[model samples]
Target: MKTRKIRILIHVAVLGLLIASCSAEDGATGPIGPAGPQGEQGTAGADGADGADGADGADGEQGDQGDTGTANVIYSDWIDSEFDANITDPAAGIDLDAPGLTQEIIDQGTVLVYGRNIVLPSNEIFPLPQIISNDNHGFRVNSPENIRLTISSLNGAAVGSRVIEDYRYILIPGGQPAGGTTIVIGSKASKQEIPDYSKMSYQEIMEFFGIEE
Candidate 1:
């Protein structure tokens, strides 16, 4: 009876040992599982503030002044003339009133006289000291009072009254400056090279002085 009881106890102890050994040994790993669904995207951040504006650039330089113009010139309208038969000695002379022709002007300024004959079809303009046919036409300055116009015969012929019909004069404020000096008259400056007014034609003189015809 004692041996049978001991055998039963030994069999029970061996079964318990086998069950513990089986639990201690690990089994082979299984295949990986399928991935889960992706999460929702986060909301975007607010926009940043705008940057400041740039400064303006610097200003440009100024330009130079222009040259002066001829504004000190004085002129006169056409004056009528008729030769007197009574004054007929050396030449036929006529005196015209010229109150503005001062002696200072005759010395330091310029005075130009021109003659025109209306009888001719072309109304020819002639600078004083001009000769027509056998007649010599000229002018002499009788300063501070009058200017004298004379007609002399070259061939000893009688001086006629039909020579000159009208006369005009231009008074420029400045004359030929001495020693290439600049002449300034009442805010007006004269050119260094004064023009030879006698050499210039009537039309050229009018255009140069900006005189209206």
Candidate 2:
């Protein structure tokens, strides 16, 4: 036989090399081999804790009382009191009628003034009287007689000099028409009208009202 046909062609070439190595993974999958280079980005997550405070809006409607700017005059909020005497013949005023002051409101022609100061605990610093309308007569806005401050004259004051005169005021109602004003004096002047208390000499009118013995 030729050696039995060379062992049947060497067993058919070893069974065709074991059927091409037993492959069933088709050849079309070879094109997907180029996609290998995308894996490096994972670190950004930390900011979530701030949201709880929103509910407060509803209360606005109470307006309707305008046009009294300076309201004719009345800004007395520093009515300090204390006068150990020395302000001759009239020592009982500083009572702006409980702040609503009325002598029919200074005879209805209003124009009061007093930012006085005569301190002396040995600190000695007198000369702060400002009772308008006249000086020497000291003070006078005593309408209808009810202690409406008729301080007549502190220009002769001297009850021994343990001195301690403190006062405050600013009332100017009575038609205001003297030009330019902003109404100030509790804060000490800016709103004009109420300047005329001159006339010195009772020791310069008691050092001009701040008095001293």
Candidate 3:
């Protein structure tokens, strides 16, 4: 009987152990542990690269120059023929009735060159002799002495067609004025003396004409 009791006690102990183990396995799992603490923030990243520049627009084309301006006196084939009188012959007095001797006509194809001024009456039409050859003649500006005006003929042509066969030259003479500032006047054959501008410098003439320094 004592041996039987001992066996029963051992079985009871083993049963208790098994029950404890089973209880532990059956219990519900605890809530998941809280998430780990957040890590420290990293340093800020570098800025992004800049975008490429836009292409430039095409350049505009240049504009053309304006037309040439018109002048008061323009010489061309359309105008009347030009002719001047030749009264240089002291033998014959001033003759105004000479044929084809007009008061004034802008003679073309002729160039009247002075100190720095090229008085090419681009409007005058040339006759047979477009120029006159006059030497020892004097000129004045505003009737002033010491002032000079020079002239030169471009082509050779007779002053008149009939008896008065004087070849009128287009060459105007040069001279200097003594006082006032102005261009000379009167004909080459005029008995009046012309101003002698030969003594004056080019700058003086330009100044007289009110030209820039």
Which structure among the candidates has the greatest lDDT? 1
Cα distance off (Å), candidate 3, residue 163: 45
Residues 22-116, model 1: lDDT tens digits: 77356567789999999998999999998755466644444443343457676778999867633354477788787567777677777788998
* lDDT values for all models: 0.73, 0.45, 0.33
| Candidate with the greatest TM-score versus the true structure | 1
lDDT of 1 at 162: 55
Q: TM-score for every candidate vs. truth? A: 0.58, 0.24, 0.19
RMSD of each: 13.8, 15.8, 19.9
Worst 10 residues of 1 by lDDT: 183-192
Off by over 4 Å in 3: 1-25, 31-36, 53-213
Candidate 3 at 104: error in angstroms?
A: 33
Which digits, one per residue and each the tens of the lDDT, describe model 2 over residues 53-102? Answer: 55666445555533324534453544555443554433444444435655
TM for candidate 2 is 0.24
- Give the clash total for candidate 3: 45
User: Can you tell me which runs of candidate 1 are displaced by over 4 Å?
Assistant: 1-70, 85-90, 177-192
TM-score sort, best first: 1, 2, 3
